[model samples]
Target chain A: MKIEVIVFGMIADIIGKQKIEVNNCSDTTSLQIKLTHDYPKLCQQKFVMAVYKKVITGNTNLNNGDVVAILPPFAGG
Target chain B: MLTSKEISRYERHIQLPEIGIKGQELIKKASVLVIGAGGLGCSALQYLTAMGVGVIGIVDFDKISETNLQRQVLYNANEIGKYKVEVAVQKLSRQNPAIKFITYCTQLTNKNAIEIIKNYDIIVDGTDNFATRYIINDACWIANKPLVFGAIHKFEGQLTVFNYKKDNNTIPLNYRDMFPTSPAVAEVPNCSDLGVIGVLPGIIGTLQATEVLKIITGIGTVLAGKLLFMNSLDMEFYTFEITPDVNRKNISIEEYLSYDYGQFCISESQNQINEISCKELKELLLNNRNTLQLIDIRDQEELPKVPVLEELLIPLVEVIERVSEFDSSKKIILICKSGIRSKLAIQMLQKKFGLRNLFSLEGGITEWLKN
Candidate 1:
């Protein structure tokens, strides 16, 4: 399955602003693994994934129309 | 003029049924201590002052730098080289003459954190570093004062209320519940490294100020058990439900003072640390006494190249895979777009190559241009 990954913070700097659609994603949780597989640069950073504004762990299931976000650790105070 | 001033000054706030006269009165009587006069603190102060928060105490030891002006809106061109708290007090005072502001131009450490926090009914942790954030948390927890916390990164921010006591138990999760362990400094980049959008703090800081008012007035669903994580890129907010474990309970002042909060979160000594300014590097280059191998470890894409006469290029991420390219005997000076990645590179190189004469330029190329 293909998924759209939205990046923020320093992660955006690596992936750039454009949303990338890639294959090998089974669900919202597995999308991170596939994206990092496709783009090895993302593997270095720690992130939490969200599906439609709710944080989803590795066990979360996803569907076709869900929006997935890759949130990185914040630097602001 | 006076009637119009009263009506116009708080027309938006007074319109809220939850924040009418009684809530506004509570705001007038509230004394809040805000730690760090950086991005979040500056925004929090702006709203609190405009809302007529009676007393605001600002704690920051950092002076205004050219870089801070981007997100720290309270300071401007004229305020450069001035103390943040001193400058913040002047600007915020001008914004609302009715409110009283206190400035503490000192660092919040284990030694003075408690006494500094005692004067306020609520505390806001706008501090950037892990050490300071944990210190503020412990200080607020010990004092039994409610905390309005806000943090921001490149395009993301998190806000939460901690230690707000209700009956026999406390409300919401403290900082510890959210982050049981601190990410290593190298793992997480600072605002300078990541490049925070200017308007991001304005959004997060206002949310923090909103929480502070809610805490004062005892109204609204305060972010007690949940952490509100917002991403500005899409303007999305995710409220994560945080459950406090046994660690949140039985926290005492003695436990706080005795513990090394930094070590608790980050395990491992940050080694191979060396820093010099770009101006100093230039002098050493000219003198020819240092005999240093200046390694430019930044990505080739990052530019406005360093002016060092002799330098080698090696991006930080590829340093390990390409370590054999550099000679171990030579004294090395690492370089990156900013000083952060260079420091991380130095740590990695030391573990692989052992400690040779190595140093990094402080503030990297960014500071070099200024000097």
Candidate 2:
């Protein structure tokens, strides 16, 4: 399935603003695996993914066309 | 007849339809204490005072710096060397003399968190770090005072109201419900390390003040039980419904205080990459007679090619995958557009190869371009 993983802050600068389509299973962990496998740099750099608008831990279920955002630690005011 | 002092001072607020005589009286009677006179606190104070919130107390231990002027609009060029809370007190006093202002020039640690926040009708969190965030949340919860919270980062910002005493069950979520665990501190970036769009905080901070007014007047929708996440780039906002975390409900203020938020949030070491001024790096490059190995970790598409005496092309993503290509023995200083990726690269290199000499070019090539 194709998952549109949006990146923010420093993470966006690293991954660039684009959707990554991965042929993967249905859970968030698998998508994370595919992302780490495709983009090796993300493995060590810790990131949080908000599926739909709520932050989900690694094992949350993912479906087709789900909006996943990769948010790095926010450094704002 | 209106008192001569009152007529001129709150004439504008008195003219408003919703905040007419009754609302004006509420403002005169209401009291609010804002914690942390940083980004959110500065903006929150400005709007609340301008709106005629009667008594506002600023609790903060930090002093203003030249860098704080970027988003902290309360401070000016002359006030650079003053304490944040004290300066805020003086400036806000002049902004609305009808309102009473109190200033505390001390950090709101667990020891004084309750005593400081107890007297106020509401508490607005403008604190930057997690330890203070959690401390304020728990103290407000214990005091049973409504708390207006605002946080901003880069182009994104978050605002929520918690612990509203009236209809308390309707507004049950706190910060803990959103983030069960405090993120490692170094991981939590602040405006100091990452650049912020200056007006972003103004928007979120205003939202916080709005919530405070709403709760005080017992009117309008407070952001209770809902977190509003806004992205300025798109001018879009998402409201996430939150419920109290069952796991964390039993957690007490003492437990919250016991947790080392500093260590929890800032897990990364001090050596992470950040931009140093080009002038400083230039002095180091010229004065030191040592040979340097520069690694450009940007994609081929980025502009303003770095003209260094010695440099190599190694896109940040490819560094870990193709680690064998470069001689790890050499002194490898990483470079990127900003300093964030290079610092992440340094972490990867350190963990995988135990590489110690890998230094990140502070502020990356952007700083280099200025030189």
Candidate 1 per-residue C-alpha lDDT over B145-224 given as tens digits, one digit per residue, 9 for 90 to 100: 78888888777888888887655664545776645455554455445655678888888888999888888888877888
Backbone clash pairs for candidate 1 read A76-B152, B172-B224
Q: What stretches of model 1 exceed 4 Å from their correct place? A: A1-6, A17-32, A56-58, A61-68, B1-16, B141-143, B164-171, B233-274, B277-280, B287-290, B297-300, B307-310, B313-328, B336-356
TM-score for candidate 1, residues paired by index: 0.79
Interface RMSD of each: 2.9, 3.6
**Against the true chain A, what TM-score does chain A of candidate 1 give?**
0.78
lDDT of 2: 0.72
Estimate the TM-score for candidate 2: 0.71
Docking class of 1: acceptable
**Alpha-carbon runs more than 4 Å astray in model 2:** A10-13, A18-25, A39-51, A54-60, A69-75, B1-18, B165-168, B263-371
Candidate 2 chain B TM? 0.71
